[model samples]
Target: MDRNLELMLKEQKTAFYIFDSAVLKKRIMHLRTRLPERLELCYAVKANPFITKEIENETERFEICSPGEYEICKALGIDSRKMVISGIYKTPEVIEGLVSDKDFCGIFTAESVRQYRLLCELSEKYGRKLKVLPRLTNDSQFGIDPEELENIIRERDSHPMIEIIGVQFFSGTQKTSLKKFRRELEMLDSFLEKLKSEFSFEAGELEYGTGFPVSYFRNESLDEDALLEGFSELINGLGFKGRIILEIGRSIAASCGKYYTHIVDIKSNKGINYALIDGGMHHLVYYGQQMAMKQPFLSVIGKDSIIPDKLWTVCGSLCSMNDIVVKQLPLPEIEVGDVLCFENAGAYCMTEGISLLLSRDLPAVYIIKENGELYRVRRTFETLALNMPKYERMD
Candidate 1:
């Protein structure tokens, strides 16, 4: 066990998430070093926006989807130009805010023809010549249809403010196979070439939202070298150079987080031994509804002396019987006072947690620095009672 982890387990008895900023920085550096020089790495703010002051300089750009996400980026001191606004829904106020900022050079993706027109409308009204990227969402083609793309371009030409810079496409996620991504690059080439041949406007960038899979439960590691090499070959072979942006999320921050929960009870049911912890599915699963098949890597802190001979069914403190974290898991003798640590939880665990569910307290957040210093980001807060709201007029 890490010294900081052990200290945290000993001092902080409540459920908390420990984010290792060092690991996150290292992961980002590793990714940046491996990717082609032209490929710009933009951190998807939705993954883990909990940035520490010390590591704030490490991340340059962010991909935001909503006003809340944009606010998070602003809170992090990120420049407005470094945020690429994506997703389908954008409030008129948010659009106005994006267009009103004179220094905002960040890219916004339009998923539909309606969204593109909306951007043009807002930008023209504000008299801001904003750089816009067309996001492919034609489900049938897995990209923007050529006819619709031309229509959007024509509409933008009619309005002098908006300029079409590039295209953005996100087909699917959790990909590990290099061959699949190679095929995607090939298809991208075809699409780009088709756009060049069909349209008169010149596209300057190609932002491909892709990244390797993070090892949550299954440990078939991604071949990063092969993927980067293959991608480079594809880009160079095509001889189409403009700008490349790689939008990454979960994979970058997954390994940097750890969830700590204290075991409250140990019992035997039928033919299995159950170790119940204070944390539940709300902490382990993303949506706090479905059970994740990937068994989280656990550590029984300070209890490595005993040999593992028992198959214990580890469960959370939720009322539902389906709140099992892991079942039939081989572990050393788990006691009621033992601490259970779940690794690889940085990306989508805490934000997706149902803290108000069953009136449970929210988990505390801590950032473990590279020097083994634990910085408390957020202290655990108890949920308000369901009947505590006194503003009821229906009596």
Candidate 2:
């Protein structure tokens, strides 16, 4: 066994884990520097709040999708002016609560007249004009149709409570075609031009919703320069002085984290080997389903003579039959108590996990640094207890 690999396996005993924040910061800074004037990167809160404090300190703005996220931002002392609130279905309480607060400058993304009316009423009651953007559907499953979007603007403009600021469009996540994006941009330009000519209304901001690809998936690369150039050209063509905002969640946090689990048992079924680990669907569901094109790469720890011939299906300790980590992956020799590390488990894994079959506690989260210093950022037990709704309690 290699000494360094053994040390790495020893490090996997802890529950939840993360990569160095300093390294993450350097990556974010590089992205910011590359697209300085052309883009305003708003860190999406859905990724992971462990990095929120660091992000708030480093970046200028962020995106909030729910009241809970809004509260998280407030807790982090992020200025409300630098936040953009966006979601498809927003509750009345959230609209009223956020609008009534004078300190919060929120942008509501409306897809229907009902939501528009609701926002208008909230703004009227609060005695403050609420800024909003019509979420336009551009041949996509989500968002409002282009004609319906125009109608929404026209109908809502008469209301003194709502201030129509701009337009928003989200194609989808993990979009692979730049050509498709170009067509969408062209559609947006045509719509904006038509709106400006007919209604004499200029847009305040052109928000391109985020779906930028990350490197967690295999054979995927985001051409930073090409993307920036395309965005700059699109903005220039629009001829709007409004800001360009991007809501990035996954791409920013995926690479800077990993999930570490120990091999609890090894078995052979029908001439096929299987390595059962202590963690699986409860911690890393994305890996189980290969969501977002994520195919995990495994590395054996503490073993020098580990052969790369045996194929093993990585299963979880949970009793559920579908609780699998990796299906028939070719890997080195493994035994009970051997540790296996899965790269790029950061974005939605920890936050979206559920302990359904068993009451096993959530993992402990740690941020590992470039110089090998580890910082215990967040513990799962308390968070689980707090986030669990009171209605869910039987006692």
Candidate 3:
């Protein structure tokens, strides 16, 4: 922990998230350098839209999964050419509006035939050629089937305004088996070869969503270097010669964020020490974590003193019993006003939590620049205003 950051945390009164811009950039650069050189990194904006601007220049492209994500980039004045419009349920109005824009040159991903037709109609109506990637799903509701995709490619001549640039496929996230991914890549390579042989259509790109796993538990140790090396070898051995776009999110942003919350109360119940914190389940989330049964990286920011460790079950301010942050962790002597800092919270924790449940106030957000200066980006927001509704006159 940096002394300056510790001093800044001591001055805070409420739970908040502090993002390190330097760490974010380093994570992006690490992926770029570690992965195969032929593979282009596409930062999934849904992972932490707040840091998109901080890493926009470091990544080759941005995977925009929804309208809100697109707005985030637009607000940040990100270049449209670097955007990859994606997601299964893309709003027709939003897609039309984006396609109708005069300067819109970003690529769009079609998950189904309906989306394909929507893009074609908009392309024809706007009198502009559109670049698209048809996503092939692994028997899920997310994307079109392989047969359906083949039909679309076979009839590509009918839609001159639409150009099928390549294929996109994403199974899921937090994957640990390299063998599973290898099979998927092999199947995809065979499909592309079939398309090239039958329709004489060579895909110019392949946007693969690498569901890279992020180690979030004490018992989990992922060999990230070995995984990346194996995946890179599998991709390089493929016969398809095209641009490779690896869509990543959680793995890149999780390490750059830290969640801070202070202990408000402490008590003993039935031979157990319970430490209550201002932040709870509504503010923190880790993939596949069940009831905080697994231990995550956390530390107590307090005065330097030698003290014996004791088992403490950390809970949150929420009224629900499920608001446990961690269960029975050994820690030094803790007192009220002692802040607990949680690491690797930069990904889905903020938005995935049930924020509006208890009408609790939202946490403040801060960013640490590369020069070690801290800046507050958002103040603690009141969610009661959003949860409450206007009273109606029944009389």
* Ranking of candidates on TM-score, top first: 3, 1, 2
lDDT of 1 at 41: 73
Best by lDDT: 3
Model 2's TM-score against the true structure? 0.84
lDDT of 1: 0.75
Better of 1 and 3 by lDDT: 3
Pick by lDDT: 1 or 2, better one: 1
What would the per-residue lDDT of candidate 3 be over residues 1-395, giving only the tens digit for each residue? Answer: 68667766766788999899999989888887788889888999888887888887888899999999999899999999999999999999999999989887999999999999999999999998999999998788999999899999999999999999999999999998899989999999999999999999999999999899999888888999899888878988999989998999998999999999989999999999999999999999999889878998888875445464899999998999899989988788999998888999999888899999899988988899899888888888899999889999998
Weakest 10 consecutive residues, lDDT, candidate 1?
285-294
Candidate 3: deviation at residue 360, Å?
0.7
Which digits, one per residue and each the tens of the lDDT, describe model 1 over residues 114-226?
77888888887888887788886536544466678767765666877877888887766577777777777777777777777776555788878785576566454556677
Stretches of candidate 1 off by over 4 Å are 1-3, 52-56, 101-105, 138-144, 218-225, 286-294, 385-395
lDDT of each: 0.75, 0.71, 0.91
**TM-score for each candidate, following the candidate numbering:** 0.90, 0.84, 0.96
Error of 3 at 225 (Å): 1.2
Candidate with better TM-score, 1 vs 3:
3
Model 3 whole-model lDDT (C-alpha atoms)? 0.91
Query: Cα RMSD for candidate 1?
Result: 3.0
